[model samples]
Target chain A: MSATNLNWRAIAAIYRFEMARFFRTAGQSLATPVITTSLYFVVFGAAIGGRMGEIDGVGYGAFIVPGLIMLSVLTESLNNAAFGIYFPRWTGTSYELLSAPVSPFEIVSGYVGAAATKSVILGLVILATASLFVPIQILHPLWMIGFLALTALSFCLFGFITGIWAQSWEQLQVIPMLVITPLTFLGGAFYSIDMLPGVWKTVALFNPIVYLVSGFRWAFYGNADVAVGISLAATLGFLVACLGVVWWIFRTGYRLKP
Target chain B: MRPILELDGLTKTYASGLQALKPTTLAIREGEIFALLGPNGAGKTTLIGLICGLLRPSGGVVRVAGLDIVEDYRRARSLIGLVPQELATEMFETPFAAMNFSRGLFGRPPDHALVERLLRELSLWDKRKDRIQTLSGGMKRRVMIAKALAHEPRLLFLDEPTAGVDVELRRDMWALVRRLRDTGVTVILTTHYIEEAEEMADRIGVIDKGRLILVEDKATLMRKLGSKQLTVQLQERLEAVPEALARWRLTLKDDGHALEYRFDTQAEENGIPALLRQLHELGIGLKDLATEQSSLEDIFVSLTRKAA
Candidate 1:
């Protein structure tokens, strides 16, 4: 739709509302990732890096920066977007949104936009924190930004889907904790998949997070376990899939309307 | 004048096969307070949900100010404001922020002046900065009202606006509704309180078992359906209603000390005078007599019972 025809006001309203909620609990929202990133650096960067040799010409401390960011971004993007929409549904405030003049696309854009923005901010914070421990360089600065934004937006869309699909608090936490976090860890967030033996490497390739981490790592050190184009395509594919699911949810009014 | 809101054969059937709302049609004129009166589980909320686009209808059409709700939803929804029965709001946000957010969500430009006016009108100006969750129930409800009115919609739906409120708050809400109507906003409220409908509505609709049993102007419904009871106090206790006064269909009450005769208020010939004369002819001296009009509650109960 053209810009003139879109409900920019309503979209902004939702976006601002979600962002306000984030800022309201800023301490709690920002603390978890900061602490988690610091712990990762202490355990993996300092202690582990001291004994391990450089992989692909990059020191271990600097090698894991992109992976560490990917880990936090994936988790935060899913969490922020999921909680943003889920809280309204749980509190019955979604009735207002469902009845408002805003369309489905506008509603998703407002929520996903805020969530991706939050995740991106958290990613940058982790990047700065990682730099404090070890020197970091961006071999491909523009590509790094593109990858960060696309990954955050894609996961935020997925999180929006989870928010709509979830019926209770437990359901909301299940996928992120039991599924996404494990995938991020196994996707080579702390280790290069190339270090794995032949059989394990092929199995690791099935994990979508591998491509995301590999692609993001390439932006930092100019190397990747998976082809960069394939990584970008996978991220775009996930984004498109999330959009389709959201469209179907609004069209069917599943779990939203009687 | 054209209706501000119209529902044409709107129906809702859930996946569980429960027909929450049967095929129903209604038209609400501009600047009138229309009350949908029904007992609990009578599809009042369902009807409101359909009209407000909260629930997709199984089959039918809803139009707000001549705009089809489905085909032109953005414009149609912009014209409506809803205060749902539940006090659903962002608990962490202050009333001021909630009102401003709601106004912007409805596609209206920010107008602090208008928001302040609404808050003051709802007696929420002082509590505007307090978190809604910390406010009293009545205050939270007022916040809901202020939020719904933030955009100044043409048609407002207040679903059970006074369900659990105290008498004082209920009166305030009634007065507020009147003020809204005076300003030419069409108001549709669902209430089980017959007195509320009697006191506030220009028209009342009675729904039962997912069907609209009756809809009529308040005065006309009362005139046509309301009945008056005549009680004749006996000088002496009677064992039974006297056979000579059988034409009146009197019922013995108060341990045979009073005889009651019910007649339609709209009837031209009520036959009360003739019944009293017949009592005297039978040498049943009357100690006193009284007549009482049936309230809206009585009519509502009878209508629902008959429908059931």
Candidate 2:
């Protein structure tokens, strides 16, 4: 569609509204991740890294930086996007958006755009905090930025779908806390999948987060648990899947309209 | 002149097999106040919902200024504003920010001056900086109105605008609605208060059990269906309405101290003269007599009851 045909003003309005809510609680929104990052560094980087030397030619402390950042980015992306849409639905203000001149695509763009922007900023902050604890190097700065942005965008889209599908507060928290968080932990956020036993290592390949962490780590250290191509393809595949679900939700008006 | 809004057989049936709005057709002219009257569960809100795009119609079409709401939604929606029944708003935001947000959400550019003018018009300019949650209920309602008008829509819907407001605030809302009409904005409001319709509407529609039973000019409706009552103060008290006055359907009132007769305004013969002659012949002296026209509330109640 032509840009003139789209409602750019509406899109910006929604985006700014969501971003304003985030800024209103900026202290709490930023503090939780920063504090969590610090605890992770103190426990894993300082305590554990001193005992376990290096993996794949990178220092133990530096090897976990990319994984830790991915974990935070993934969780934050899901939460920020889900809560952004969910709060409006809960409060009944979504009626304005639904009745406005905005298309479904514009609505998604405004909400997911704000959510991804927030997650990306949090990821960068965590990276900075990680640098304070350990020396970090980036072998492919451009690719690293690409993976970070793509991951954030893809997860935010997924979170948007979750927000629409969820009928209650419990339902909204279920997927992000129980499903995504556990998957990130089991997918190698703390150690390389190669360190697992034969069967476990093969099983870890099925977890999508492993590919995200592998691709992100490859950008930092020039090596990965899986091939970089497969990791990029996997991330793209998840993004496409999320887009399909979001499209279906709007088309069917499942829980959005009656 | 083309109507600002046209609903051609619009209907809404929920997924649970409950038809909220039956096939209904309506045309509202520009620069007029149209009041929709209905009791609870009578599809007043449902009809508003379909026109404002809050609920999709099960069948038929809604056109706003020649644009189909479904096909040309962007243009159609741009021309309309709705203040929903619920007090749903961004409670954390100030009235100024809320108005600005609403304007932009409707695809309008930021015009701080326009927003300020709307706030001032609604008497919310002094409270512009306070959070909406902290404002009184009436002020919050005014904020809803300001938000709806911020986009400068040609057609506006106020659903139950004074549902829970005090009498004084209700009068203020009535005045506000009139001012909006003077500015050439078409106002359509659904109200349970029939007096509100009597007070302001150029036209009135009555919906019942998902069906729009009637729509007519307010003055014409009152004249056609309205009735007049004649109360006769008798010189002496009686235990019952005398059998000689049976033809007039007279009912005893004030413990038979007065006799009442109701007659349709449109009837060719009201029989008032014949009834007076009969009373005189019966030797029942008249102390006094008075006549009163029935109100819109009476007409509304009779219409809905007959439909039921």
Candidate 3:
């Protein structure tokens, strides 16, 4: 068989394998994001919105809605891809997959694709679910789709790296939960960065997730706390950096080496 | 016969400063069952991993079916199948899906009859619809083998294929391995069970401390180094071996009820007759005598012990 034909087959297998694994536990994979996003809306939007009337002409409930949706999408996408790849390692079944004729490119694409799918689906669910509480208005439908695609792709790649680096379950949760989640929340997921002190506002711009949330929020409201151009540039920059790391890991075989 | 697989100074050293495989060279011919017998931590798995393209060799080259494992990895990997020690499969997946998916991983088209035949051969046809997690340990192992064989690889690596398995499954597995060999599939197995190698291996290779100690045909290995023991059950108890029989280095066992003599089978004169004659001269009467042949386990222990 041709080399291209061989690679395509390996890629399909890895993708199918990863997809089957995630879907095997669809309850935790699919439902958990919806439920968690719902709680975020109720607690951060409804409960917290009871006092804070408005932030930048938008109601507090609606203002945090885009940020929360993006937060869920980014974290879950990254988590699923990372955890999905890492599961084979923990279970010792990774040996079987690695021993197969699949190339690293195929391996990465399969896992990232499955993870991006999960992230996108969950992001849409959160968007739909949030509309029930406060109508979600998409200012630029095209930009919104772009934001969703980039956010999911970037985080999914990041998550794949996390999976390779992580040796244990605790290690797996550390980056997404402790590092990424905190950065997202403090990056102005709820209140605008404009409300923060001048010095803190500048520091928040350095947070990659801040640009992701801002870019995605701009897609929804057209009025973002930061420049859309800067947000898009930062998001793209983060994606490139992440892609570089993943490509390097695959080249070296990293932890996937037996 | 041309070598089906060849390793040229292959080595693997983990980043942790542990040398998993020492630089070693070896060759395995086509249509032969080569058993790699090694104790745990002897680098058997590392060699298998490198040959199958799971781990990068630290400082050597490996060629599978004449294809370089590293430089021509895609072709090399396509020609081989590895039945790993671990039982890795999705809890929700059926045997059919897992095997088909694995075959597809190698870019093979869907062949339901091949999949079904492999399943039935492994005695997994009835359980093909069952989730892998639900199967018994022995059955799960079979599924692993079936999955490995799904792509119809010319070479198969069974790393401790029978480890931690039941007797019935072990026997069935060996039988299946022989059948696979009959169909021209080269089998390279790493086993802790010396008897398994003795029973199934056409050629035996021993690895220890990340080094390849020896590689030879099973019969040749045994015949060259194998020994025979003469055990005599005496009719009367003797306090000690006769002084005249001291040259024999004989052993007195069970309070001198029996005498044991070890001799190389390959020796021109086995010296058993001389020992027996000496015993008769010493008035050491024998009730009954039996001979036992040395096993592959004996040869393996002696080889590893000598290297240590």
Candidate 4:
């Protein structure tokens, strides 16, 4: 614990520096999430709410609210973290960070922490924005908070890995655009897995984003297509795996070493 | 005198099948400015990177303050600071914040006074609050130097510290380096500018094709390899040199309008009198005469070529 404590100063410095950088353009980093979520509600909630009725004892708009918000949180967390790290590399500012005496763990924690902070702030803004569109009931605030933390952490770790692996700007967009966005859409963010056919329901479980969205949905509405524990477990597992990969990359110096 | 840094048989082979740094051995004594002179692909950066623990060597060992850089990285790195060749600093950070952050990374307690001193010396104190991106290229380079010196390491590695900069920044950097050396810091610098090494280095090491060709005291290296040349401008052109003039081993240029002779000043006898007499015997008339001595650039090029 003390050894880890020794890294807090460095980690805090990095986290503060990165967070300050993110906040420099608060219009894009903070406001975009609120606007994006509001738009999602306008298109999906007002337009399609009349036909779908309620999902699992909740209105369709309300059913998708938590999922949509969580989706934004995860993706933005990952994207922010990935882009944050990638920017330094692209701009050649990574040399400054690399030459410093900060340990790899501190560097990792600082970046992921900033990413998580941004994602959480965005999620909160989206949550507040969604309240204007439809009534949202919270079944368990503690469970909801747990779900938010787990989902944000896992996705931020994924983003951290993406940042480390990315070599170019195009490469940065490929994962978020081609892989992450599609995963969110197919992860049952807008629809419950119960609405899926037999084979598709089973396949949806394999998408990690599905578990995250389902778990967050369960926290809000007390209804889910899958068990929250299993989703939580999956999120935890993914977080661990991501941490392992990040540690390995740092230890080997991978692409970070000059 | 104890060596603050030593490289023994260090070699690096990149994945692209390029041998970046060959096996080499050298020592950097404490409180001296040692310059590593090489061309673009001469592995100067690679060598510095290995010493700084930024790059892993494929073979051999590097010791800092008698600590193996690989085995005791934390301790070794704590005692060393590296100013990389590239001017890479966080554009979003202010110089003060960046330097403070760098000091934090080294696990050192906050030393505002020290950082302030470094900032002032680097001429960045006035711009301490300004964003790095807003600073000019030369200012950013100075920030790099400040960041490297933040920890106050005993051994400092400056890779091409004066690559691209205005004369003012260059002069300031050199002055700061000398000040650091005076304060008992050992500086190991790599530069393509021969004059930078010639003007600043107490000792010079020439590396070529990833191998260290020679390492000697600056004055000694020059005196040992330096050559002097005497040039005499003839009053008139001659079709060919006479047999007596041949004894001077002089080469007539511009159809005998000039005669160039080379001699070693270190030799027991330079034979300048004999050469002048031979020119007289050949009826060669001189309009003007002058002598020039070899510089570090000439010695570097010749050493590298000879090794190749």
**CA shift at A152, candidate 3, in angstroms?**
0.4
By TM-score rank, best first, the candidates go: 1, 2, 4, 3
* Candidate 1 local lDDT, B1-308, one digit each (tens): 88998889999998999999999888999999999999999999999998888898999889899999999999999999999999898999999999989988899999999998999999999988888999999888889999999999999999999988999999999999999999999999999888999999999999998999999999999999999999989999999988898989999999999999999888889998899789889999899999998999999999999998
Q: Residue by residue across A50-165, what tens digits does model 1's lDDT show?
A: 89999899999999999999999999999999999999999999989988999899999999999999999899988998899999999999999999999999999999999999
Clashing pairs in 3: none
Instruction: Go through the candidates in order and give each one's DockQ.
Output: 0.89, 0.87, 0.62, 0.47
Model 2 lDDT on a 0 to 1 scale: 0.93
Best of the candidates, DockQ: 1
Model 2 sits at a Cα RMSD from the real structure of 1.2
CAPRI grade of model 2: high
lDDT, residue B140, model 2: 93
Candidate ranking (DockQ, best to worst):
1, 2, 3, 4
Q: Scored by CA lDDT, what does every candidate get? A: 0.93, 0.93, 0.87, 0.85
Which scores greater on TM-score, model 1 or model 3? 1
Q: How close is candidate 2 to the true structure, as a TM-score?
A: 0.98
- Candidate 2 on B150-257: residue-level lDDT in tens? 999999999999989999999999999999999999999999998999999999999999999999999999999999999999999989988999999999999889
Q: How are the candidates ranked when ordered by lDDT, highest leading?
A: 1, 2, 3, 4
lDDT of 3 by residue, B78-123 (tens): 8899888877776568989989888988778889999999999999
The collision pairs in model 1 are none
User: Candidate 2, residues A1-258: lDDT per residue as tens digits?
Assistant: 788899999999989988998899989988998899889888887888889979998888889999999999999899999988887888788888888998999999999999999988889988998899899999999999999999999999999988988889999999988999999999888999999999999999999999999999999999899999999999999999999999888887768878
Give the TM-scores of the predictions, in the order they appear.
0.99, 0.98, 0.93, 0.94
iRMSD, per candidate, in listed order:
0.7, 0.8, 1.8, 2.1
